[model samples]
Target: MWMKAVLVALLAFALGYLYHTNPMLQNQTLHLITQSIPQSLFSSQHEPNSANLEETISRAWDALITAPTRQWGRIAVGVNACIDVVVSGVNLLQALALDPGYGHDHDVLHSKEDLKETFIHYMERGAAAERFFSDKEVFQRIARAAAEFPGSQVYVGGNAALMGQKLASYPELEVLLCGPVGPKLHELLDDHIVVPPQSLQETDEFHLILEYKAGERWASSQAPQANRFILSHDVSNGEMSTLETFLDSLDEFQPRLVVLSGLHMMEGMGRALWENRIKEFAVAIADVRNEAPIHLELASMTDREYMSIITKEQVLPMVNSIGLNEQELLFLSQAGGGPHSDLHSWSGIPDVGRVSDILLWILEQHGQADPDSEAHLTRIHFHTLAYHVLVTVDGHWRNQRSTVAAGARVASSQACGLQAVDVSKVELKAPLSFYSSFTEPKESLVLDPSNPVTVWQRRNVSFHLSPVLICKQPLRTVGLGDAISAEGLVYSEIVSQLHLD
Candidate 1:
């Protein structure tokens, strides 16, 4: 009787407090009441069917800047930031007992149901997408509910912020972050990452990622690939406010590498608003020194005009390097009128043949593929669940063997959330022997477990293919892409830099 009375008293107080105070964080408060989930909720690990790439992975780890460069390099990554809450996607859906309907289309989340339905709509196809939400109360209820999961976590999230943090991990690198880092975010960022004074905003919004593993099933849909579905509920990042002060300070830093991302946040904000912000981004990008290289990290975009504007008139052509996953690659190809213009959604793993065609088109048309081309694009890094490829204009990049391996290693380690990859939780899914290009299979290159990084060239462009050790139980998937791109960029030696011999 006493325990029941205590429970009643606690429930009454919680109701009264929520009725009067903040409802956005109600999930954070209620998680303490429910029993935490047990380890059994996660799936069992898998051992490799064939010999795993342990020896190759170790060599890559050992080569992790084995000789830390004596010369320091400065890098800048920015233009958006938000709080992130990550939870086991399948488990959370089960907890809700929600059979989210497929094909729900809405640019902005109208209510809690809209959020769920839209999430499943994309999840069914294993596409990476982000939808903006203005219904604060509805989003709050849903976000807080997801956070109630026992293992749910929060971090400073967004392409710019997360990539900046990843870059700070490298030695002899000065990392400057351009994104919102108010008092609350300041504590979450790495102490080494420099947050300028102008990039300040109140932390009212949080991005929720329902992360799942490969082959994880949800109702009738089975995820063909390991990926994330993001929901953005931030007015600050959606407006591209972080870049406001970034332009004024660009010359002060004079970074060797300038990274621009999160422009997709402006999508769904009415064309007038996003169009103007794109101009601002172009201005900020054009300010880089002629010698330094700039990279644009692509995101999932739904608006066709937004994507068309990217390749047709604006930002993509200004940067020399870019990083994107399969889904984003397909979307860009369609919008740019490349090979796969008919694809509106994907049902399974993206075909390697189609991916090569698009990457080649981007290089030949928009990138620096032509000998006398004034266009700046020279590098493209494409990542997938089973593999990663780094393509660059020949003679513009070096250290392919080690740089490509480093990218593959981070993809495994980051997604599994392991300090170092624990082979017990992983298996090699990448083919031991495969065709290097889309051309008629003349012959396939065999992968030796001991020496796994594959290098082949196509005319003037160079290709480095590194297979990933698939993680059976992915602990986190939100920032794995950013981490992979950062690793590849750090280990790379770009041209136009004077190196001490």
Candidate 2:
């Protein structure tokens, strides 16, 4: 101890003169010295390890199963409903029965040939993307081709539709779903879900979902992660036909929470029409804003112009909370005129430091932190393949650990397409070890098995990150994000006694 103290004193004396003359050089020297220190020296906290991973999975499930559920909480979900025609691991050329010519640049899908090219474009890069097909028959053709695959199935698809069903599963919660429910969707939805008296005469909108697993090969294209790309042609949703009907029922139903989505459906409907629809949505959201917490679940919007309008005019002032995936998160930053607005999209797991920075920016710049902020955005639940991060204002949100754990748990179960996640069929896909922030890599956020939910504070908000138990064989990738968001909201409404860690 005496020798170490002497050495420290000698080093400080040697660098003290340099520190006063050139602070940058002295700081750099200190950084080098600290960086040389081994990570094991900081193991007193918790290091992310295999044992910790297994324990976290166990604890997350325990938290979900025992979390207190909100009862009699009236929740309104609306603005889109669709039948998803799902096809997994499809061969783009064989499905279309046409050669895309591979090297051509077809940014927009117009004809059938353009559709094949766009799919190939994203597939080769292992990216998840959505393309709007203006022609209704173009989507129908893809649906028909999907039917040729043996195990292809049809499921409820849409932000409003899928989330309403998941929330209604609690039995105690009163879930009012506002959308056109054709005969097929009505049959799939639970009886607990209240379908408002709306236009039942409308034809069912269809979304073709093509799913690809990591390492899934189609010709020269291979996927980097398990994900799905959506293609939509909606006659009803594109027009905002149900907005008035939904807003009319808001007074009588008197929801505690209002969830808005599917505005992205208006992307390809031209500027004037789409802008007008977003303005109407903004009004609808504002009407319910005072009565309840409004959560916006974001989806794919290929049009940057539309993204800008929604972020600035609509989402900035009305929505209180939000749920989005990695791609949507980056795109929101890019489109919303945030700090990283230049960033368009990202593939695979995004960097934690970057994601954290964006979340902080949204909360500070436009969230409820300020007295004049209209949207009063209090909470953000961001989920991806590897992990789930929940950001919330100090006094506005509670039980964050359980809320985030529920999100991570549901992500695994729903992706596996199982009512209950099988422990044996899952693996720890998260990074064994990760830093709290890339800017401060010395502060390692090692996963502690005893404490599954990693908690931290920065400025006015609290951040919670929970690692996910990824399913080894994903039976269903579609609707997983919706399931995660729904589950997170369910637990967020009420504090749990069994789980707070």
Candidate 3:
């Protein structure tokens, strides 16, 4: 017994010494702890109850519709040349009392004919048209108006302008609408072509979103609570000229930042078109990088399957930053070969450490895969219902500046949340009640300079984890992604840049 005890003590001491001395072992230990955090610290019980969700949604809706549009109007006035792409059609929605059949959770079914049939059935069942606006027109008008204040240019292309006539709200901001416009759109826009529209066979189709509530229901005949379904037709053609037009605008305008969205285009057009578009855009952005420092950001990526392709082909090559929600992050991580891909749901909030670890792993994998890639991502932002996590490539932003930017982003997102429910005149400040139960004060993690685990050692990465203002019940979830992305970018990029200037 005495001999065994001595052997055990020596073994333990040796292992401890090795762990302390070896950076790789230390990182592995840290990885294990972080990997366990989600299951241990965050559990399903933390999810908001159905009643709370309903109430929150109701209140948010009431506040949103009644809120004044001028609040956003002010935001629109501050930005410069916000360009978006592809199909920006109206969203037709219906809140279903029925269950979401089987195998449909956050799953988008893409069938125009099937969606049309569903739309007709829902209309017959008393569903209503929630709101209608052309994404191209709305985004263009707002961005153009905002850019006018800065005396900049806003160029909107893709299928967004394919069906609509060019309308410039502000002369100072040239709203150049490019894309194939059919005879129907030609007639509607009264042939007011700012740039001659490319001839395409069809216009973009409207998106239909069906939302469902919660119940313990399953694949069985038992009905689901309420759920949402979205349907949008694909209009992502990989033609070189289409991309050339967009690149031409980039070359001419030479804007500081460019925002790319419309991931849904992949569903209809297949991965081929998606890949071509990304590669083309990435090459174009790289070629023009020497002329001006252009920042590229991608948003509204609902589909996870294409994330790996986008990350490797587009993001690593040229894109500077990428923003995604928790679920999207989970999917991307899983698809991109991260260990924690098996999470059942994102309802339970993850802590800062766990979130950071996952993001670092992703960055490490991507960086190692293509060390020769021209552009290295400067930031990876993951926004959840409860909090926001930002991982900046070393030296991107100072700690204090990042914290302030994060707080400002939180405030802006909260306002957009209220606006999502149709609340008019969003207050500049976030209400105290908006803070989530899982949220604490913003936490910062400065990577150790001497012992870094990430593959890229050129700079120390900084992570800022900020809690979000909670809305117990949210009336609408449709535009929340867009709102969050738009507001956060405006605050971090536009507002902060302006303040600095």
Among these predictions, the greatest TM-score belongs to 2
Error of 3 at 440 (Å): 21
lDDT of 2 at 423: 70
For model 1, residues 89-134, the per-residue Cα lDDT tens digits are: 7777667766645657576777767767776766666667778877
Where's the lowest-lDDT run of ten residues in candidate 2? 492-501
- Relative to the true structure, candidate 1 reaches a TM of 0.83
Q: TM per model?
A: 0.83, 0.84, 0.51
Candidate number achieving the greatest lDDT relative to the actual structure: 2
Report residue 170 deviation for candidate 2 (angstroms).
0.4
lDDT of 3 by residue, 18-122 (tens): 566863354344434434333222122233332232233234322222211112111111011112221211122111122323222222333333333443332
Q: Kindly state the number of residue pairs that clash in model 3.
A: 25
Tell me the alpha-carbon RMSD of every candidate.
16.5, 6.7, 14.8
Checking candidate 1 for backbone clashes, the offending pairs are none
By summed lDDT, which 10 consecutive residues of candidate 3 come out lowest? 73-82
Whole-model Cα lDDT per candidate? 0.72, 0.73, 0.39
- What lDDT would candidate 1 get against the real structure? 0.72
lDDT of 2 at 109: 62
- Model 2 C-alpha lDDT per residue in residues 1-501, reported as the tens digit of each score: 465556567656866776678643544465454345433322323444423345446654574444544442788899788888888635644667775347333434677777666776666655666667877676677767776677788888888999998998887789988887788888788899888867454467778888888788766666676777777777688786888888888889988778888777778678888877788778767867767778898886666677878778856556778998887788778766765566555645666667887887888776876656655788899988888999997877677888888888888777787777667767665654455554433244545544667887776778898888888888888888888999988888522222112
